[model samples]
Target: MNGNIRKNIRIGATVDVVLKKDQPTGRLTRGQVARILTGSATHPHGIKVQLQSGQVGRVKVIVEEAPSE
Candidate 1:
């Protein structure tokens, strides 16, 4: 990712968010990014994610594409 600890990440920028462990087919229990660990270490990865909740974990996923409006 391109953000440090305690910073609101931008779209396309990867983030290390804290995920839970009780996710559904199309739902999640997302949380704050405890700390960025690995992956790009500069940019986001995935397009759409379905991370679990409650459990603190790292996910190298992109927030969203930059708005062109």
Candidate 2:
């Protein structure tokens, strides 16, 4: 699903995001979410998050939800 909504994303979820430098090219980086950075419930651009790989960006696509423990 799309990644504009904060509720749709979760910590540890795998997702595709656009880094600030890659926004112009619309490049997407795939990684597991480490932490959510967006405070609001929604964002026009998408919720900001930090990836497990230490990459910070706005989510563009929700690839896979982290398995519930």
Candidate 3:
């Protein structure tokens, strides 16, 4: 699933994101989501979130979407 939708990302969901500094390089960092930072339903650049690894970045792709509640 795509990461553009905020609803697709859950607190414990695993996703791939591009760190602020890595956007130009398209570097993808994989980790479980720690928190959802974006309040919007969707974002053109994908939702921004804090990873379990304490890394904050905009989601690039959702490796594994959290199950719907």
Please estimate how well model 3 matches the true structure, expressed as its whole-model Cα lDDT: 0.91
Whichever of 2 and 3 has more lDDT, that candidate is: 2
lDDT tens digits, residues 1-69, model 1?
323322334333334443334323323333443333443433342222223333444343334423435
Q: Which portions of model 2 show Cα errors greater than 4 Å?
A: none
lDDT of 3 at 25: 94
lDDT per residue, candidate 2, 4-51, as tens digits? 999999999999999999999999999999999999999999999999
Worst 10 residues of 2 by lDDT: 1-10
Better of 1 and 2 by lDDT: 2
Top-scoring candidate (TM-score): 2
RMSD of 1: 8.9
Query: Order of all candidates by lDDT, from best down to worst?
Result: 2, 3, 1
RMSD values for the candidates in order, in angstroms, are 8.9, 0.5, 1.5
Query: Per-residue lDDT tens digits of candidate 3, residues 12-61?
Result: 88899999999899999999999999999999998999999999999988
lDDT of 3 at 2: 85
Instruction: At residue 15, give the lDDT of candidate 3.
Output: 93
Query: Model 2 lDDT vs. the true structure?
Result: 0.96
What pairs collide in candidate 2?
Answer: none
Model 3 segments more than 4 A misplaced: 67-69
